[model samples]
Target: MQIRLQKIIADSGLCSRRKAEELIESGKVKLNGKVVTRLGTKAEETDKIEVNGVLVTQPSKKITIALFKPEGYITSKSDPHHSQTIMDLLPKELSYLKPAGRLDKDSEGLLILSSDGELIQRLTHPSAGHTKTYMVRVKGFPKPQNLAPLSSGKLKLDGYLLNPMEFHILSVKDGKTWIRLRLTEGRNRQIRKVLDSLGYPVIYLKRTEIGKLQLGNMKKGEYKELSEKDISLCFKT
Candidate 1:
């Protein structure tokens, strides 16, 4: 019944599997009183496992949460620079949940956090093809012809070709243009970079949806625990 060390740590709600690997490589994880640093090392459930001197145990209940992340809060559990993190918005009893995906500090919107390692993997993995929707406000207004190339999957940034996306104008007000985009791929700062390249320079950006899970009317910095049915909505292509 031996399981991978990272999986053991992740299932114990200590951290994501990726972060568990980092902890193992940094010699912060030990198996049966001996440091085990190899990525694929395995041990049985009966064996004692420790992470940063902490004994690991599986939680009796698994929890998933949908958080309305506000701008300026880092999406990580901890940062070396001591910046405020999303964890600060949660109660101490729910500290074991890890963010499934990230929203940069400058952007605000729907963010999912979960204690289920498999759910985190499915949501973050590229193969999942989950659609994320964003509401963006940018400077100036551009013609439809100018944005037609974006939906054709011909947009390139940093020498990388992006996937086809759905982009359309939602409104225009006071010298600013509001638009919505649905993207199947999540690239680093892709929306901001794309609009900037198109000469529209984003003024504001917020993600409103992931798959069929909508942000609803949740206020910034508020979070709600998800029921099993609600969690399934995230995978409803």
Candidate 2:
């Protein structure tokens, strides 16, 4: 069966569909040694496809892993300024894999890096409803009344109302307090902003879970290859 060239590139997990289209238009994608820049170009299974001189083929064995990202590492492939990225922490054998989503440099937790684009899409897409849980330490403890707006699901941020989430106090220590939050949406810098809006500026934040996947006891900078059974467990949560 013939499929669009971009589908083949995206299914290979090299990039998203939009990025694949960009590569095709930039004359970087070739089919059977011929540069094909037209979108919607169809290619059959037997046809050879190459991107930037390397043959494009699905991996024989699919791979996915849960990485405990430590603070200070950017969640990107590379940076022009030579900043360290999460990819630098993985073993050379897993360099081809890409992060399904992001964890900011300051937030450390369970980061799913995988080669399965379909799985990545299902887990990260907004409609998936895979709630991410975070342990947050804020500057000061706010009374329950102030925290009510966050859980009510009506908190407006920059003209956008947020999806309903659960915020609970986990512990109270001197000068700071630890709280747990469950979020349905993965907005950039959302956890900090949400808490800050409630008069509790977040000082430390770490994602503890995403769906059924848990950070567990994994130490900073540690990574574990998830088996088929292990991957299946994530959806159950």
Candidate 3:
């Protein structure tokens, strides 16, 4: 049976359906030796599918990796600014995998890379409401009342009102404060922006956990393949 090219790619575990659409629009996908830039193009099992000149074949096994990102590495596969990207740090065999969610160049910690489109969508989609926990170090100690807004869902910024979530102060010392924050929404530079708006500018931020997955004891720049159990726990219904 013929299926939409994007769906075929997504089901093959290459990327999420949304990213498949991007691959198609960018002219990176071809069907039966013909470039297919249209969103609704179809391909059958008999049709040859190629992405960037390499024929698409179903892998014998699907893979998911969790990487302990270090500061100064970009989350992108490639960058024009000559900055080091996470793809450069990974093994060449994982070149086909894509990051489920991005970490800023200056920030660090728990990054999930995978070929499983469905799992990627479950973790990255805002509607999933998965909580991401961060250990943040900021310049000054903020009053407990200031953090109340984080849970009260009253923190408004840039014409947007953020939902209430968990924010707990872990410690404060030497003019620096360490706090733990949990957020369900993954807005761009969200942690930084929220802290900035609170008058306690962030000095450092690292995501320590996503859902039940923790970055415990994982050395910086190291990566580990997710076990079947880990994957199952990650997507538990």
Candidate 4:
């Protein structure tokens, strides 16, 4: 059977389909020792597939990982500015894996990385509404009325109206407020923007859970491979 080149690379645990497309576009992928930059190309099992001169073989098994990302690391492979990236947090053996979603360089918490692109696609899809929970510390405690917009399902930002999200107050200490929130969409800097718009101004933020996976006891910069059950959970949720 013939499969798309992107699917082949993704199943090989070398990268996600999106990243595979990028590699193809950038002329890093080759077929049968010849560079093939065309998207949607197909390959049979007997055909040779290589990326950057390395053969891409289908994974005999699939694996996913959860990493406790600390602040100050980019979630990318290479940055021209020489900033540290998430790929730096993993061992050399895990370099081919791609992140399922992103946590901005300045925000940190439970982040999922995987070789299974299908699972990554499903988990990262905005329509799935998979819960991504965060612990946010804001600089000042605001009156409850200011938070009504979030609970009311009508907060608009940048001309976009946001759906109601979980915005529970966990505690308020001194002059700051610690809150637990759950969001379905992965808007760019959404949590920070929403809180700042409310005049709270995020002082600290860390994601604790996504779907059934939790940051757990993993310390900063540490990661653990998911069990078979946990991998299944990614699809279920």
**What overall lDDT goes with each candidate model?**
0.88, 0.85, 0.84, 0.84
Local accuracy of candidate 3 as per-residue lDDT tens digits, 64-169: 9999999999999899999999998898988878788888988999999887766777777778877788999998889889778778877876778887879889
Give the C-alpha miss distance for residue 190 in model 1, angstroms: 1.1
**Where does model 3 exceed 4 Å of error?**
1-6, 12-30, 34-47, 50-60, 235-237
Q: How many clashes would you count in candidate 1? A: 0
TM-score of 2: 0.83
Worst 10 residues of 2 by lDDT: 54-63
Each candidate's number of clashing pairs is: 0, 0, 0, 0
Q: In candidate 1, what are the lDDT values of residues 1-52, reduced to their tens digit?
A: 7889998788775667899999999999989999988998998868889998
Worst 10 residues of 3 by lDDT: 228-237
* Residue pairs in candidate 1 whose N, alpha carbon or C atoms collide under 3 angstroms: none
* RMSD of candidates 1 onward, in order: 3.9, 3.7, 4.1, 4.2
Which runs of model 1 end up more than 4 angstroms from their true locations? Answer: 1-7, 10-31, 34-47, 50-57
Per-residue lDDT for 130-160 in model 2, tens only?
Answer: 7788899998877678788988877888788
Worst 10 residues of 4 by lDDT: 228-237
Alpha carbon deviation, residue 207, candidate 1 (Å): 0.9
